[model samples]
Target: MQRRLITSVLLGHYLSAFTALGIPLYLPRILSDLAPGTPGWAIGVLFVLPTLCTALAAPIWGRWADRNGCRLSLLRAHAGLFVGFLLAGFSPNLTVFVLALIIQGTFGGAMAASNAYLSTQFKGGDLSRALNWTQYSARLAMISGPILLGLLTAQGLGLDLYRYLAWLPLLAFVLILPLPKDAPKHGLASKKAEALGELPQDMPRLLAVQFLFSFAMVVTFPYFMPFGEQLGIGNDALIGVLYSLPHLVYLLALPWVQKHQGNLLLHGLALLAISNALQFWSVHAEPLFILRLLSGAGMLLSFVGLHRCLSQRSQKGSAGRLFGWFDSSGKWAGTAAGVAAALISQSFGIASPFLVACLAAMAAMVLARPLLMTSREIPA
Candidate 1:
């Protein structure tokens, strides 16, 4: 039963991630088709608005999930995602597309929902393994979704691609139907605890680090294709490969890192700094590909490490709210990064965002040093 639950959740993560990432890979193209004269900054707005909405909405959904059951929460979020994808696919203009993203953001809590659900099922090494698998599934989707979608769209599927792919999560929703339901464990009690001023001590610092990590990671997403174009690579399929190769490396390296999960927070920060710095020098495809692979390694380490940290530190009965706030912080930071990236890219050159990311990563590494020195081991 536990294995089945894990499988279901992992599949959900993969499908949901695939759907979420597909549109972004083609966002620049999609915008050009819908609104021909939109500037890069406006492109940034489209990305930022949804994340801002998601940032605002995650905690609410998390609190609801803590009150309700995780399965019910998953169902609600998947339904919202389905509707949002349909709305985006069928929309007549960019305005509706933007609305679709808003809806998507408002209801999207698949990752947090999955994490909260799994947190109930496992602990210690088992918990770490489950969370690592979740991250692996997401990274797999990141690696494959773009490449496959890019290939199909390149073959003349065009905008129809969105319509076709929208059905995937719906299929995943069907898989979710058979999972055994669990009762809400600490709904009202957790709220009462919060009212009485009981909160995790390390939460604020963890959230700050999460925000910085997200900001550094996401700031370059909207500009990758444009940057590639500047380097003379225009084939969407090839571009997808360039973008995904890093995730591939990350996926490959995850297992080894999981087994030796020592001071990953520090390792992640260092790698992120190096990866972003390398991006500033990557004017060609080969160098950029290598740098992206390095960046993926950094991202996987950071994400897995932080998630494990959160799981360890979560107060009893408050996992949902904790994960929700964690997700919220990342979303908000990502929203800011999107806006900053657009402005930076517009004001400077396309390569400037990478430098910004590099600087942020360095700062995070420095900020994390004290925390790392104080606590070096994952709590058992």
Candidate 2:
């Protein structure tokens, strides 16, 4: 039964991620079709607007999950995502598309809710394993989504792709229906307070570290296709593969890292910084591919380390709220990073965001040292 439940959760993430991330692969074309001659900044706005909405809504959903139940919260989120995707698919103009995205963001807390639900079912090494699997599934979706989009778009179905993809979240919703439902429990506030006491003295610092890492990541994400084009890789399929290769590496490496979990925060940070810096010099495909693999490994290490820390600090009853805050922080950071990337790219150059990401990663590494040292003293 436990194994079945875990499988369902993984499937849920995979489907949800495919819908959430995959549909966006066609956004540039969609926007072009809907709003011809749109400025580059508009693309960033379209990407970030929903993220900001999601950031705002995550905490409320988290609190609801703590009070109501993770399963119910997840169901609600998935339903909303389904509707939002439908709206986006049928949108007649950019205004409708933007509204649809906001709706999607407002209801898209499935990942956070899923994490919270699993946090209740496992702890210690088992918890780490489960979280790593969840991340792996998400990375798998990231790898496959673009490839799927590229194939669909190549066949001249680009305009109709969103409508087809809209069914995915509904499928995810159906998959989640068979999972065991958690009942609402009392004393959640007290449990949260207790968890707070168990948290490290510099918990805020860890949150800052998470924010910086996410910001660094998002700063370069939406511009990858353009960046590849700048490098003379014009084929959509090739660009999709370039975008997916790092996540593939990350997915493959997750199990090994989960097995050998340790204080790898600093090392991960160093690698991530180096990888981002290498992007500046990657005018060719081979070097970029190698650097992307390194970046993926680095991201897996840092993100897993942070998530483990957060999970360790959460009490069962309040896990949703805790993970909710973590999700919110990352979302907020992503929102800002999206806007910053657009403005930077517009003013400076297309390549400037990569440099900015490298600098941010270095800063995160500097701030992470104290946390890393302190984490070593804590018992796993």
Index of the highest-TM-score prediction: 2
Tens digit of per-residue lDDT, candidate 1, span 1-380:
88888998899878987888666757777778778999987876675666778789988887777667777777777777887888888889888888888988898767777777777677765676687788788778777787778778687665556667778778778877788775665544665665542346777887888889889988887798888888878797787677777678777887777787565877887788898888777777767777777888888878767766765665445667777888899888888887898799999999889899988888877776665665536642
- What C-alpha lDDT values do all the predictions have? 0.77, 0.78
lDDT tens readout by residue for model 2, 286-365: 67778888888888888778766665666656666777777888899988897898789899888788888888889988
Q: Please, what is the TM-score per model?
A: 0.85, 0.87
Q: Which stretches in model 1 have alpha-carbon errors above 4 Å? A: 27-43, 92-97, 155-162, 185-198, 225-240, 281-290, 373-380
- The positional error of residue 288 in candidate 1, measured at the CA in angstroms, is 4.4
Clashing pairs in 2: none
lDDT (Cα, 0-100) at 14 in candidate 2 = 85
Off by over 4 Å in 2: 32-41, 92-95, 158-160, 183-201, 225-239, 281-286, 346-348, 376-380
**Model 2 misses residue 123 by how many Å?**
1.2
Predicted structure 1: lDDT: 0.77
